[model samples]
Target: MFKKIDFSFEIKAIGYAFYFSFLPFLFFVFQFLFGEKELSFILLKQMEFLIVPFSAWWIIFLYHDYFEEGGSDLLYSYPLKAEEHGLLRIGVFSALYEILIAICCMFLIVRFPDANFFVLFIQYAAESLLYTSIGFVIILLTKKVMVPILMIVAYVSTEFLTEGSITPVFHIMSFNTEPLSLDQIIFSVLLNGCISVILFVFGHLYLRKKTDLRLF
Candidate 1:
């Protein structure tokens, strides 16, 4: 299973994803260096707001190969079954994303040693998976990159326009005055994790039933 995964592809995708993810961090570093403590916090908050949308976008980018003409054919011709291949690819990408998050958190620790960033990292990771899985299902169903891209845009727009209160599930990373309770954390993880699993399973099944690469 591992042999089927293209480590080079995963690394390149992750590198691109982190390039976006680290933008806020770069601002945070600038603030820290200039002794702008207040601004650093604001930058961190902004990072939280941007992470989910960017993460979702990265997942969509990673799946672009599957939508290409010869690329889809090559993927389908692998030795493994379609569902197995898809699942392995998802697993690899998801794991790589989490690792990237962990690495970012290490850098964040240096800037805010007192913050409970471990918990925040878990929350962000769960939200990332949730958003990515939604995009994954959309791509598998429609086989068009633009559909999922638009869906992500609509979701981010709704979240921002409504201030994270309207669609709580989609805006899990939005700013909050108070710290999240243990129950809230558990709920977020469970809700997103369940939804991600269901979407992945449905996409796998849907892919298994299709014999051609035509985008519907």
Candidate 2:
């Protein structure tokens, strides 16, 4: 299972995306090395962008390899089933990201004692998994690299431009952000996690039909 994941992750684009994903965590490194412990809410909030998006890109990258590059022809003959492979790859990447987010939250507990680790974890996990699952469905459905990219751009822009009330914790986490409440976390988790699970199931079902695997 790990070997197959490694094979899928070895792509040049995924390699770069993997490294780029860590760019947000550099703040933690800077704080540790320089003892710059005054972690402002705005600075912490800025980390949200780099954290969730690249986490979603892993499976999309695999779709490029599996379908766009003619790897699906070979994959149909592999020992593992397509759905199994997709699930394992997504599971590994999502676990790694969730672990990383926990580590950062742990460090925040020390430096920023008032920080709410529980709520943050829930929010990040929900956002990450939602987008990850979105990437899975979008890539498999359209087989186009740019569709999901544009959708993500539009989604984020709408949130920022209109400052819409579309998200659960937006007001809680935005301007002069405070530690989110348990109710907000619960709602956000349910909303995003349910959608992610539904999309994941759909993608898994879609991947099962080898004959339907064609580019748009």
Best by the lDDT measure:
2
| Tens-digit per-residue lDDT, 153-197, candidate 1 | 777677666778776655556365333545568776777778888
Reference-based TM-score of each model: 0.76, 0.79
Give candidate 2 misplaced runs (Cα > 4 Å): 1-4, 7-13, 27-39, 165-176, 211-216
Estimate every model's Cα lDDT from 0 to 1.
0.64, 0.67
User: How many residue pairs clash (N, CA or C atoms closer than 3 angstroms) in each of the candidate models, in the order given?
Assistant: 0, 0
* Angstrom error at residue 45, model 2: 1.9
Candidate 2 weakest lDDT stretch, 10 residues: 168-177
What's the CA RMSD for each of the models? 3.6, 3.7
